[model samples]
Target: MGDIEPGALVLRRAEPADRTALAGTDPIAAAGDPTRRASIRRWCEQGLALLAEDSRGPVGYGVLEYTFFEQGFLTLLTVVPGARRQGVATRLLTAVEAACTTPKLFTSTNVSNQPMQQLLLKSGWRPAGLVHGLDEGDPELFYLCPSENLSLSSTLRTFPDTVIGKESRI
Candidate 1:
């Protein structure tokens, strides 16, 4: 684990006990149904839930959903309202990227969510294009990391050796 801002925040693997925090504390709840909950549990089981915490408790969480496309997707990520701008989301993004060495990762955000767009760019994800009516007329901005750039061996050499193959966790 690493420290950012010296005692202001901590990043770590999220545990099963964090389920409630994820459901109730999320800044955006995608679907309020059993399916979403089940998916979250599956991510936790796969070791894909990474969280950010502070003096109080979990302030941010990111869940990744793996696909056969050789590229992984960040299915969900939320940072509690008050924790915005503290780098919580960034930490989670970094951890997830380290684990999933898919040469490219993909995530889409509503065109109106400028902050999400900014965050994605800040995390090194390149904007690919816009998917119109992606969610019933809600255009989503897509991002990608090319296969040539995501070669597992290259990323492993750039990142800590501990993260090598962690993509299999998903």
Candidate 2:
């Protein structure tokens, strides 16, 4: 467990050992697709796994993986009970966004997950549309921001024009 803030929490990269912490949560594991066990393993192997920790261990975790078509994808994001409304998810997203220099980014959440939708919108990611049946019977909501607009390189830090599902050479 890490130190908790007075009214918030801290987010950091998760180690392989943190798997146990993640598996113990309901929303985190339950939100995972039934057939994605192997994909989860792959995400752990290659993607950036992050956790939000407070005085009570990990309360949230998000896995971000590289996509074959897009520059990157937000594979998963879950915040446990007692940690909501503290900006933990936002911090996790911020770290995820800061980790890559991709020209485009993508993430999908179940249509029922309104909090995540709000979080995505608040984080400067605009919704493209709903990706039907991508999450079992749930409609997956898509969000994206172009890398040029997402550059942290000081020079190109300004925003760029971005649209969902748009093709770009870079």
Candidate 3:
């Protein structure tokens, strides 16, 4: 409803107990897509999901996995419509990047998703390439954020010595 202060939000690895709240924020999952729900569960189980929460509840979640040619790939990033443009995606992305285990983290969004492209660019992710036929008309644009580019100071500044569970707050 109101602007959410970035510092007021908590970013941590998603757990089994978080599946329902995480799915509720996802449009597809909320719409009763069983496949999407299953994917969310799998991501959480595999330790590849990050959840963003404020006092209100779960606002966003991200999934990063090494399924893309053995390198890190951000397969999903979902922020509730109400939470969209308030830095939740950025925080989720930064946390995903921090959790990346490979040298290069890659992600792609449909060309029609301009907001995502802008977010990736502003967050220091560079355009890697583009591929057609992924979404029929709208091409998929790939972006990359190399591990070397992730400075230690950026992570420290974002989290500010916060750790909420077995996982350190990102």
| Candidate 2 lDDT over residue span 85-113, tens digit each | 87777766766665555666788888999
Winner on lDDT (1 vs 2): 1
Q: Which candidate is the best by lDDT?
A: 3
Model 1 lDDT tens row, 1-170: 23335446655666777776676656334457777777666766666777667767777788766773757787777887777787777766665676565656777788888888898776667888887866886798888644444464345532222323232222
Q: List model 3 lDDT by residue over 67-90, tens digit each.
A: 899988999998988888898898
Can you give the lDDT of residue 110 in candidate 1?
Answer: 88
Misplaced by over 4 Å in model 2 are: 1-8, 26-42, 68-70, 135-137, 146-149, 153-170
Return the TM-score for candidate 1, rounded to 2 decimals: 0.74
| Best first by TM-score, ranked | 3, 1, 2
On TM-score, the leading prediction is 3
Distance (Å) between predicted and true CA of 120, model 2? 1.1
Look at candidate 1 and give me any clashing residue pairs. 103-150
After best superposition, candidate 3 residue 143: deviation in angstroms? 0.6
Q: List the residue pairs that clash in candidate 2.
A: 103-147
